[model samples]
Target: MDARERLAELVQEKGGSLAGLSRMLGRNPSYLQQYITKHSPRKLEEDDRRKLASYFGVAEAELGAPKEKSYDANQEWVDVPRLAVDASAGPGAANSAESPFDSFRFSRKWLREQGLEPGQLSAIRVVGDSMEPLLREGDDLLVDKSDRPFRDGIFVVRLDENLLVKRLTSQGGGRFSLLSQNLSYPPIAVSAEDIELVGRVVWKSGRL
Candidate 1:
């Protein structure tokens, strides 16, 4: 059993298929498969290799450990915050476990792939059905505070110091109405002076 054999075992034990591993490393699964199957000793780009190593809970050198396929997925779960299943809370709570004071490091390429513009928006977790069908509960929403109000769409608003996400409806007479997508919830009317626009939803993503 050599390094390649060890890597294969690690991947399998960690519940990482070639495709899932590819996403973490930002590489093609087919290409990785060739190297893993053929002992081709293919070199990974520094960042991608680092990410893969991190995902595997091992150093780059250890990725080649001799074939003992014992790995724990729980080791990797620590970084992710526990998400609320329903819309009990707004996007404000999704990554709330994260320290606001801690600096965040993210791949710019990944952000672009998710249709997020850096510094223009903040990410929030949706926990309620106020905006449903269009934006489901447990979805991640990106809000761009700098985005000015234009046509009607979903937006996060702060009314009376409470944060909520709702559909913005522009009515005549300089008034706006916040309507919930779910019929079960009633609409809230706001005067132009009282409404504080937090940001508009630029994009959303969710895990199935």
Candidate 2:
């Protein structure tokens, strides 16, 4: 297909409108529409094309370039939605709306090795220094919504309408202690009825 057709297909796949793509690219609202419908500029500029391709998580070749493979064909990908809210590692952060802002693709093979199901997984950002050393600020945690059995490990819990990421230690008798990696922060003890288990933290990723 032609560049216009390819661009239109990608925009639709991303659930983005031409006007929205135009604004994201710092162009007039009508810029993308005109380019897609009419032959005004004939094609997208190199920079605009690269930006749009990256935003849609697709190679430039797929968005109307020569028919060359830009990505590995043997690699399988699964898209995981990234929630907009932060699972605070220190003080609890209120997360009234659990909406997703973006998505990240992971290799299916790697996910299988980790025994992670893509459908039941979500990515949330960590916002505090309580779980430092292991999980630093700005770390992205992969949570398993299906694995909420209250085991003795790290988990994302909701208490008093706020979300927190803490290490759970089962003290028995429906009681547990939330431990933090940082010693300066004190552990919190709570009964089963007091806190709600959001999900278990299965994996984490952050910059070095």
Candidate 3:
């Protein structure tokens, strides 16, 4: 059976309605039902397909993921969890609720070349337009959780009860100025103890 048929079968087996599954995918309640019955939009977006495959514990290829890439038998690959939380550039993502909704596969050699350890990494998406021109909405960022030294760079930080992605500069005396690339937003000064560092954004897995 094809992807649509397979998805329909899975939804049936899970004993849930298409509307419920659509909600789980954060889409309109009729999203899946229309996709299955009407086939509008022609195909599922890659992110949505990947998320469904993970949630259902199935291979992405089974959901029509471009027949999968061929990997060398000896080359090592790593799976980095893509947390389902936005690192907002504007107003922060409140409470920073997050969980691994999918994963990104990268060759082990590539990670080593970048001096990034696989175990100390996670992926998240960008939101809002504060860091525009450099980082845009929907860009996927590879975060280095182990590289937590005070430094000048784009980073994910927790301020108050919200999570944000901003450039940080040391203000000395245990203080920092959160800088935005867009410059339309003003800088925020906070003590080093007040800002919780989530990770440094090492690379963006989006268009150049």
Candidate 4:
């Protein structure tokens, strides 16, 4: 069935009213009902359309009436590389693999230029401010697994095998430290062996 018809069924199954769906999508309740029941689609901006799709657990193109020529599967293909999330890599880590993502292509290119290589490099969505002013939350990070660690450079490391993005600095002795760009957060220190250097960060690009 078409998106509107499917949405009507999904809303009923989920015990969600048009008002509820409107709230979930941050849309006006009345407008949403008209769009869904009457198939009179509204001219929502792209971001709003994306948010609506995410709220409905559907694709952005499916937010309104089903468009003609909408079922071109080849046009929608994504080239995903296998990426391991270290946190979820225990016991059946192999089973919980996520589809490959293309967020880190440039970072992968930079790694290759530096002679550190991996089968593939993927961009990871940043979620914390541990890297602070330098790297904000939601910034995409390029991690190069084939590159070795350096004394003073930003790197994506798995501490005790848990993934983290921080700066590696020499602590004077046999110890190395993870430094945070934000002054409020303290640094982390550990032995070289305990830290697994997945890759050094070559470049970061994002607006505040």
Question: Each model's TM-score?
Answer: 0.47, 0.63, 0.63, 0.47
The candidates, ranked best first by TM-score, are 2, 3, 4, 1
Q: Between 2 and 4, whose TM-score is larger?
A: 2
lDDT of 1 by residue, 28-87 (tens): 556567677865546545555444554454545555422343233223221111222122
| lDDT tens digits by residue: candidate 2, 57-150 | 4666765544453432234886666877899999889975554567678887887798765546778999999999989999999988664345
What stretches of model 1 exceed 4 Å from their correct place?
Answer: 1-117, 147-149
**lDDT of candidate 2?**
0.78
Task: Answer with 1 or 2, whichever has the higher lDDT.
Answer: 2
Model 4 RMSD in Å is 14.0
Q: Model 2 off-target regions past 4 Å?
A: 1-75
Cα displacement (angstroms), candidate 4, residue 6, comes to 47
- Superposition TM-score, candidate 2 onto the true structure: 0.63
**Which pairs clash inside model 4?**
80-100, 81-100, 104-123
CA error at residue 152 for candidate 3, angstroms? 0.7
Of the candidates numbered 1 and 2, which has the greater TM-score value?
2
lDDT comparison, 1 vs 3, better candidate: 3
Query: Model 3: clashing residue pairs?
Result: none
